[model samples]
Target: MKALDYTILTLVIIGAINWGLIGFLQFDLVRVLFGDMSILSRIVYALIGISGLYAISYFGRIGKAME
Candidate 1:
């Protein structure tokens, strides 16, 4: 569970960075690496979305840990 949390967190961070790049520089690292509209790029985007959803539970875990 701990490793899973870390992995999801890392993915979320990567997604955040990608969004930052898109917002500020008009660049998408995933599309650049995988090709525009490629299946691989789509998978990467989906995984990032899933990771973001998983990360929503992080606050609950942290609150429990702090107790």
Candidate 2:
């Protein structure tokens, strides 16, 4: 369970950094590494999307902690 959490956290961080690079430098690291619109890149994009959605739930918990 702990390992899964760490894995998800790592993926989310990677996704965030990739987005940061894209926003700042117009780079697409995943596409550049895996080929544009390739299956592997699409899978990675999907995983990152899912991770982002899952991470949103944590924001509510943080809000609760502050209250």
Candidate 3:
């Protein structure tokens, strides 16, 4: 995969893990690291959202690669 795809996937994975922690343990990695609603945490959230959208495009790429 290309660099952009890799970056997005990494961000998405991180976000997913954070969400899992939050849901299962009542903890948030981003908030703990950056303070609630801090600039850094906000940026991470934005990147996570964008990464999720970018990941959707990879669905087609994977389909093609599998053929």
Best by lDDT: 3
Clashing residue pairs in candidate 1 (N, C-alpha, C atoms within 3 angstroms): none
**Clash statistics: count for each candidate:** 0, 0, 0
For candidate 1, give the lDDT of residue 2.
86
Indicate the residue-level lDDT of 4 in model 2: 66
Q: Summarize candidate 3's per-residue lDDT along 1-67 as a digit string, tens digits.
A: 5998889999999999999999999999999998899898899999999999989999898899999
- Better-scoring candidate (TM-score), 1 or 2: 1
In model 1, which runs have C-alpha deviations exceeding 4 angstroms? none
For model 2, residues 1-67, the per-residue Cα lDDT tens digits are 5686667778899999999999999999998999998999999999988887877777886799899
lDDT of 1 by residue, 1-67 (tens): 8899889999999999999999999999998999997999999999999999989898898899999
**lDDT to native, each model:** 0.94, 0.88, 0.94
Q: Give the top-scoring candidate (TM-score).
A: 1
Model 2 deviation from native, Cα RMSD in Å:
2.1
Better TM-score candidate (2, 3): 3
Ranking by TM-score: 1, 3, 2
Rank candidates by lDDT, best first.
3, 1, 2
> lDDT of candidate 2?
0.88
